[model samples]
Target: MSRRRQRVGALAAGSVVVCALGAPVAFAAPATTSEITGNGAWVAQAYENTATGIYLTPQQSDVEGPARAPFGSGSHRMVIGESTVQTELYRTPKYDGTPLADITRLEYSTFARRTNGAGALRQPTFLRLNVDKDGDGDQDEQLFFFPANNTDQQAVANGVWQHWVVTGSGLLNVGGDAGAGSATTLAAYKTANPAAELINNDDPADGTATTADGGSIALITGGGNGGGTDSQANGEYFVDRVVVGLDGVDTLFDLGPAAAVQTVATSGATVTPSNLQGWYHEAYDAVDYLDSNQAFVDGPGATPAGGGALRFALSTTTNPDRVELFRTTQFDGTLVRDLRTLKFSTFQRATGANTTPQQPVYLRLSVDTNGDGGMDDTLFYAPANNGTVAQSTWQSWDAASGVWGVNGDQGNGSVTLAEYVVAHPDAVIVKNAYQDRPGGGVAFLVGASGASQMNGEYFLDDVTIGSVDAATGRTSSAKRFDLDSVAPAVSVGDARVLEGNSGTVLNFPVALSRAVPRAVAVDFATVAGTATAGQDFTAASGILTIPAGANSGSITVKVASDKVREPHEALSVKLTARDYGTLGKAVGAGSILNDDTKVALELGKAAKHRVEASVKTKAPVAKATVKLFRVVKGKNVRVLKDELSKKGRLSTVLDEQFEKGTKVKLFAKVRTPHGVYVSETVRHTVR
Candidate 1:
């Protein structure tokens, strides 16, 4: 007997309404240009005929009369003997509604976990999407099936869940090797001589898909080798979220604060990983747990609309001793490099052992920016500079003032988050600092984190990074402090001069600590050493003006020269800070090179069939090596060496005989305390 496919209605449109802290969670609404479609997560249907009890939970199993709970927090369908279930969307479903005519593309993203008995298992799940080409109720001719594999035995039956997406153009694609693709089309299945199942790349679960007159699609997840045995045992499944787009937003999972803890405690239960679902934590100096009762979180909105939230030890404390995601590398920092803002929600409470009246519940943003495999660059949204989070209230960090903080070393010497966003727009390897002074050279979740290896606790949720435009609600005028109005730290620039050349302009570079809002200037003065002022070089003093938002500027020093050959001399320049900011280190050094033409060339024939180099200096040549060179094809080739006559003169002969009128180029070289100096090249035709 042919089993008639049963039709199940689409579930509710929105998810459980939850509070952000003080207000409602405004899920990242689709920007004005686009639309959004989300079927409340964990609300799909399940059906089966097996004797094994069916359940409505996403956990391995729930104690809350889970079997009869209808729809669990992370819900899924229970499958038995070729039984089927439905996946719905708000207005975007082409299953039962008019096919979107503007369907330039179709995309699907969802999270599913398998639930099956120990019985021998074959692939037992599949998703069938349909489109009604005409107004006719049936979409049978327009259905496509994507089979899901349940090959991992360890995760079988209420096992680990995985995120999946389908890119539908002409073919259904998973985009990566993990998702299997099928060559078998809907048309191919109907034409097989014996009507073979069109399993495609997905292992054949022998499951079939069909559409009803209303264009509603259903999945007939397969049955056993032959119905009558446990080998064809029933299969159960769970779906946490399903999103479809005409153009819509993707779902994101924030770790805590409003994150409902699935573990219900036995009275007085201590913090432990065994009691956690969808979370990874560490505890000490504070007790962290999923308290089913509202009082435990004490702070407002302690309960998720769904009835549980992960709680930490405080509303405020210098010690963050707390909870974090499973591991550090879990997030790729570069994902937000281009974004100007990172937004998230959190709940705070001045309860338990942390009764400090402070309202801030904060966390730092750490990214593996250096890629040495650790989050070295840390940005802190300091509560003192950043506003304190209200107790029991939900707040949004729009990358606006209160949200952008300083570097992890606690702001002593690091760029602000806002500053980094402007500077490192291509950074990757970012994560929230999971441990204190997290050490270098460790995997995202592995070894060497400092003292923070086990300290700090807080609740947070809804983390998202966006660009300035995406966060239109945020504005530059909103910075917490008037950074532009105040003066910032500055470093003086240095200059160098050439005593022999005089008239050389030496440049000094002045660096500012942070960008400021207004144009500002710094005063500089040169203090002479062995070099005199005005005589060797004019003394200089003036303001180096820097424009608004500019971090550095330059100044120039003029150098004068006279007839003198001396050692290099250096002068120190001091930069005094302007009224607006405090001064940091302020001294720079300049050098004067004393390069003079000390050697005189009197080229003459040694009268012994060789060329000669007679070198003379203004003073007696002292401890200097005199050398001779002959030009060959435009290049100077060393020809001979000679000792200077103590009276500051030398003449040398060529080692090689030259042809008549070879037209060789000659020059005299001398070594000075300053450096080796060479005289002007003199050409002498072979005499």
Candidate 2:
């Protein structure tokens, strides 16, 4: 029969409790939204079957007996007539079992009874399996069948119920019979008939027997009279010791209502927990773990509520020597909503250990706000380990004083205003820190509220929370890198000056302690000197090099323009250093422009000169060679050697060289490669 067609009924004292009779059964309570966020724990009720055992009274249709022990119910009893019974099963949150996969084996023990002088009553039984395979809250597969034992049996006597039962297990065949004797092993049964049907039994004789296997079978009942009398009720069957085998096991982390748990494994690597809310770091020291346990409560009711202790086991080979804890919490105590806590416990171990120590591990606790997976608030406690006792009470932040402080009181501490503002400028104050110390135990309390409390990012690293030195008594803050130690220095050498000239070199000196990726620019400006339109003085090279770790270097400056006449002009040479670091910041000097002196000159009158002339010829003289000569102080002097022409003419300036009233004689000579030619003497007088 189909799963929807199966029905289950409970035979109570003079009453029948019908559970799933072609209807949906609700075994678990509906989950609420608040419970889903806070507690994350829920479970379904247990399912009971009452119609599969012996009857207490012959006249009564229902069976009742001694109370059951395991689940705190009554004795094993069932109705004695032909009827249909159904029971509803539910899913539980904390059961240590696996999800039902393929069916492995189904075995149950039952006792049959034939009564009322009947010619061996015949009864056929059916079983149904239900599952929400599609996640649609409905049963998917149904497995139903009749037993193979529906045959004739000899009754012990008439008008009395005789017991004839099958207590051993066996596989159900397609025809609903004990498939080739009784089933002794699950693997053998599964291998025999891969598509076996449900087991059912029908006996024609009035027989009664007790069955020990009661927990395996889901539902069992009897119907269909044997003698074809349409009596509708005759024989009865009792079931017990029902055992079903299935696949994997379930973990406790899957207890929440719609909660999902993911497992990850790594070797020789640091583990960082991510995508968490309302908590700080997932690792902590031992002392901090104890402190947080005292300060915070699990859920609203606080009794058998949601939160509980979290445990972690290290590998056998890990022998940790030291450990630390980290957490994330809101800096400001305001914005209490969306608050979460993450606890981390770490241990340091030896290099070549095969087994770890049994005791002495560190623990810590942290709180996260804004949901950024980082802890904004953290608490630390150092527990007694290896016979060492802890002396400090508790460590927390002081927002008012803007520092971390210690509190000795056991009650919850107050909010720290100043420190909170520095860490979270936009946060609002909600709750403060509180601690409890009794019986040599320490606890720290933290509370707060603000807008979007469940939003933001937070993180934690390995460090102390609020410990201060006894001598100094100063709190510590986070560390960060000085940009003010970089400057530039420059120097200019002596300027070379040339009279009435330009284009001179001016040298410069630069010093640096290290090599830098930077560009140096040098510019020359006229300070006081003026240059003529035609004269040009310019900077020859604008870039300079400072070798790596070099103390000093020289740069040449060119003067392309001339200085003016008035006051001596000066040229300003500016050197700019770009991209300087700490060493460069030490020097603050720039380009220096200075002046050099220059002088002017004047022109004088013209002087007189003398001239004589001569000429030589290679071929016959086709033309005459005239010689031009000058005389000084009545002495003859030659200026021009000769003048070659068809006819020669000569003139000389003798008066300019001689005094007034002086007479002079001028002569000339001409020669060729073949011979020589001489001209007659000429006389000139100066007056």
Candidate 3:
């Protein structure tokens, strides 16, 4: 005889209920839909004796009694047969109230082997989760799986392995319960059933456990005995730890940082918020809070019945070039509001020294009052160049016919009222407003453009519609530039001969109008009657020192020797100032010189018996001519050759050679366009 024992009761939470066979009483609920929020809460209540009926189909039709038990405490045996079983529990919405719509998911995996020395042959067995709706006995919905095999089990001798999978709806399926292998397999009973969620759970030899968190039950088998008997008759399978909820909600269901929620109390008044709400999800769609770039409607407290006001203070390193406010209904797609506009302020220098002065800044307001995203009204203030404010109103876009106007009059200041009507077709009444201090304010809209003024040092207080307005007072408009104002001045001092009497030393004082000085340059004359512009003079402790003995006083300072210099030409030196707030035009006086003409060269030669002469010049030297004469018996004899080239240099081979102990004289005459300058006669001896 076979003995059976059963226990029936609710395990814990209101999630699962179980009943013993042939018992009138049944367990109600152990886990509820709301209590299964955390992990491990539903594990104890998952398994129960819930099967309704079981049918077995053997592989061989002529097989007799049940197969012998190869590894078990009892005499029950197993047979090689296909089986189909149905559970009594009616699958609903799991633990959550959200309906489990479709099971578009399934899977299977495990380790197994044959018992009769021959490899086990897998026959398909379907596992299905049936739902009985409308109190009908027939299942209205079912998640089924077709037969699956474990052909990879031949590698290990009943080794352990694990495998699992997840569906599109986040369902997890795991299979690894039978310890090793038996006749346990999974199959889908329905062929045309809608797609359902399923996954495999097979344990590996590495000792890692696989879980089936949100899927249906798993199928596993016990390992066969060495005596060719199936040992899967009395083994128990475990199905624990299940969860169901919205995707990504398990981590982010709490309210974000506490936000200040305020209400508006005026009509026809613009309302702005202090803090902006970022992107968020509400139900199936994402949403975002209001932006500062859009026109707003007052809630309930302005002149009209439905108006309110809001204000925000902002600061940035760069000036507030522009600011815009916008409102929208959807967060993912285009904005719902048809009107989009921007208002901005321009800045200018106000006060301070020319090198480091303060600048004054002003604001300009423009708007596209109509639905189109184009500017219809423009107002500008010139703080630096222009002394007055400018206003313009123009009509261009047509919302009705979708045609734009070409000749619309754009008026300035008071005359702009007539143009405002055509410009902002959607605006009932357009008005420009200005506030100077705490309570003093004026309306400057349309014809009142010049009436609204904010002068002197005043804060831009709140622009509210009612008594409950939040306005902050402006303190000062003073700003300064980070620069030096005074221009740099350089002077060339007197020259002192440091090395030889022929060498010259130059000195000068470089004074800066401002305490902060940048750089300076100096130049010197060369001995070859030319300016050597390759030399550089660097500033050290606000002073540039040049050695007087270098290159024999042929060194001159190269001014402005930056990378972009002309080939051999030197840069001209000048005293100039830069980076001053309002003093960029200021400069100091400095001295420069053209001292190349002051240098002289001397040459010497050995005394000789016969004489010859030659002369050369770099620049064109006008002259009467070159003459070579010899002294014979105290009487001078003139040579036959006498010629002058365009250049100053002259060479002459003597026609007659002088006798030993004879003296020779060579003279050169240089003539300018004005007059002729004679050179001292030079005499050379010929060997």
Per-candidate TM-scores read: 0.27, 0.21, 0.19
- Cα lDDT of all candidates, in order? 0.41, 0.28, 0.25
Query: Against the true structure, whose TM-score is highest?
Result: 1
TM-score comparison, 2 vs 3, better candidate: 2
Winning model by lDDT = 1
496-586 per-residue lDDT for model 3 (tens digits): 2111122222332333222211222233222211224334222212223222211111122323222221232222223222221112212
Model 1, span 127-191: residue lDDT tens: 45554344444333334334343222123233334333333322332221134344443233324
Decreasing TM-score order of the candidates: 1, 2, 3
Candidate 3, superposed: residue stretches over 4 Å from native: 1-249, 252-323, 326-683
Full candidate order by lDDT, most accurate first: 1, 2, 3
Cα lDDT tens digits for candidate 2, 200-248: 1211112354321222123334333323352324544333223232321
Against the true structure, candidate 1 reaches a TM-score of 0.27
